[model samples]
Target: MNQSDEVEITLQVCDPKIIAGLNKFIVYTIKGMDKNGQFDIQRRFSDFKTIRSFLLTKWPGCYIPPVPPRKAFGNLEQQFIDERRLMLEDFLKKIATLKYLWYSEEFQVFLKTPGEIEKALLSVPKITNEEIINKYQDAFSDLSGREINREIIQKINDFKAYIQKISPMVQNFKQIAKNIAEAKSSFQASLIHFITVFIPEYENNVLLEYVEQKERLIFANLIQNEDAQGLINQYCDLLKEPKFQELYQEVRKEGKQLKAFLETFAEREKYESQKANAESRQKELQLELQEVLAGKTTIRTLFSKGKKEDHITKLQQQIADVGKEIESYQFICDILTVLVGYVEIDKFKMEKQFQYYNMIKNIISYEINLSKIAEEFWSKVLKSENMQQQQ
Candidate 1:
């Protein structure tokens, strides 16, 4: 093909190892195929084939075939090849950038210098060496920073000295600066390790024993205090005193009398109130009873004459209602009598005990009989009434 017909395709090599090795291979292929000190286009194609084969073997799923001579690759295959080429170019560019950054003069100097520890200390004026030591002490009082061991500290100090010596040589002290950074990091880490691993082992048992002893001492001192002794003595003295004994007896007697008076007063008040209400109710009931007993005042007379059946039904209902009212009044009166008798027995200070007791029993018996009479009266009134015929 003519030079114009030949497409110049740039192959971007990604991995440093791969780039180095492939570049060598390409150079060797170019040399081997050169004829009469001239570039051979066919030999370049052969190099492409060999490289393609190697890449396909390494990454089986990757690698697209070259377009056929008469037909260009389809849009999809062209896009895929474009994307792969872009990715490989990006990878190579990143490697070149990293190499430039790694070998820069500033980075080389940074690796060499003993960073100004004094400047850092001055910037943070509040954090002194004493403060750092105190912090370690507070965290782990038993295992001192010395637990990091003399050899480790000596090595760290030596690294610091070496960094300082090489600090003036800006280009040549990269390794020293790196060593100093690493040593500082190690020292800090060892301090933490000492506190975590060694301090607890040293102090755990001693702290427990010390705490127990302190507690015992505190308790012993408390028991020996004058206030504690005085409290005990006061309690004993109160138990033994004659005045206390007399006062206790008097209080007991007063309490018993007060309780008895309260109970008696409550009973009398209850009975008096009930008796007054019952008497008032009885007067009202007596008036009703008189009205009922007067044969002229029958239920038929109370309601105006209407339809005969309606009138009769109303009369019967009135009779039943009046009978229930009389029974309720009787029940209330009986309850009042029993309560009054109980109060009389309880209130009469001079009454014979047996007489008071007998009065209560009689009152209760009277109440029972009164109840029976009321029930019988009600039953008779209800039974005699021809209620169904009235309705």
Candidate 2:
């Protein structure tokens, strides 16, 4: 164990400050301590993203968790800055748990450095089969360090495709619940405005105005919706965990291992892009060699064939080498993905559904509850008025 390695670490993100420059940006205060002692450093979102890129390159197919998605707009707002701060803080803490990542010299530098750490970290070297096994011997217990191959890569591809297909629909169901809550608030607002303001102005009867005022107060209290709109909207806002909150709590939540496993796709995408470029370059070299060979048999053209032929052969070999690396990396990725499918993510009940219909049921039940509250309020108000008239 290296003396510099962080066996114990504590982290907190704070002091989100927005920099007003030619281009606006935000930075966070990351306070952390390990064996190396405590340090406070300021880092930007792009800096965190850069570290992710570095990790992906060095440890392809490793389970690197994601930070929050970058937002070009609305990022300067204090709320967004705080949310991002929490996410970045979470990302760093996860990395700290993995000795392969957190204890590395590169990662140590990244934590203390404020800006781009690209020059500080080693450039990613070409990967070897042995290196893959060495990095993962302890990373995932489920991997078992078994042999991996191209066929498993195909399995990973197919599995990821299926997940991607279902992702939108799962997200849409949650969004719909949010939308329903929003619509309830909108309707609640419109009804209150009609009863309190517009109707009171036109009706012009003292008794009617007095009754409407009470009605307005009731509806206003219904949400206190005037102050703010949160997840659980509408008259049900009175409930601790109303329909929306119930649905939010009930639905699917991703486990850390599953989240980590899914993020490897970004690493895979890089190799896919590299292979595509190599293949394209090979084609271009072949065409150039042909043109050189096709020229009239002159001294200059004839002599060029040897060089052109060698270049084409070299290009072809380069493409094949890239293909092999892609295969090896995909094998690693497959092992990680399977860990999630078979055992890793089961720790979180990753198989749960989105609870769409359940959300609808909650909404309907909330409406029923609202009806009861409205009746109770009206009944009490009228009883008080009748007692006043009898007196």
Candidate 3:
């Protein structure tokens, strides 16, 4: 038969009790076969020949012995059933492991659900027993969602314990990292300031003046660069002083600001980019409004032929369409304005008293406030009659 026409056969023994019985029978058959005899033709032949020779020499007229049964004669069907049962058990164990692993939080978040697993399984043409085992092994090592979750909880507990046990030490380390970072920043700032201000004032004597009047007002202003080498030197000197050292020690007792500082620094770039985009969008909206107003100026020419009903209807439809467009733009603009703290609403041609105008403002305000932590700004804007009366 052609490969396509060939029928695929599979056994579907569903009863758990029957499966258990088959497994037991197979195990017993295997054990019995093992105990029956070793399958070594060479050894058997040697023993048989030696016995025959001895019998012939010791007592004339000895008969030859018959051959033993082959290993397959023990219990072939039972062995087959046992092997199948073992294979099925292994398969089930692997699937169970996968299920447990997939349910784990980490894995679940990535895989989403059991349906994903089913989909993946269905995508393949056919999965062999060996392939399934191999996949299970491969997937198990990385299936750390449960372990990761447990570790996360344990880590939180450990962190809390650590805080309780050596909070002072932890604080000290934090302060040290913070101090180092701050010192580095201050040193840089001081260098800039020195180059910009003090260096010019003192000229050749700048370094000398800085060192001599380290505690002076002018030097303090110059050394605000937290990363300046000169500032770091001054900090070390301050550490030598009893009063300053005591203050430094007390500050060290406070928790470090390293995490806070690093987090802020990391977000700075994203915040700046968002701010720039908001500003650009605001400008674009203003230009668009100018264009709309300029276009509205031409509306008077179109209406120069007395207010005909048809003309009025067309104008009204056009106005409505423009109003809808304005509403959409305003929605976007409002969000930008709220994020950036200002929006230029005068760009659109819709009158302040227009219903659409109020609708746009209200919708924008609602959406912006929904996203914001504080709604005071949005609330005040919505409360104004200027937007309401315009509609």
lDDT of each: 0.35, 0.60, 0.35
User: Model 2, residue 154: displacement in angstroms?
Assistant: 7.4
CA shift of 130, model 3, Å: 22
Lowest lDDT 10-residue stretch of candidate 3: 27-36
Ranking by lDDT: 2, 1, 3
Clash count of each predicted structure:
2, 0, 26
Model 3, runs deviating above 4 Å:
1-168, 201-391
Task: Give the range of the ten consecutive residues with the poorest summed lDDT in model 2.
Answer: 248-257
- Tens digits of per-residue lDDT, candidate 3, 1-391, equal 2342232222221222222444332221111001112211111112222322332222111111111112344333654344344433332232223333323223222222222233433433443323433443343334222322454434434533543566567666656756654575476567545544664466335644544543333333333544443533543343232222223332342232222222222232333354455556556544544544455434444546744444445555655554554444433322222211111112111222353455456546644543351243234334444334435
lDDT of 1 by residue, 22-127 (tens): 3321111111111112221212222333333332222111112221111134423443334333433432232223322222223222222233322322332243
Candidate 2 clashes between residue pairs 3 or more apart in a chain or in different chains: none
**Superior by TM-score: candidate 1 or candidate 3:** 1
Model 1 ranges off by over 4 Å? 1-249, 252-256, 292-391
Indicate the TM-score of model 2.
0.55
Candidate 2, residue 361: CA error in Å? 16
| Leading candidate by TM-score | 2
Order candidates by TM-score, high to low: 2, 1, 3
lDDT of 2: 0.60
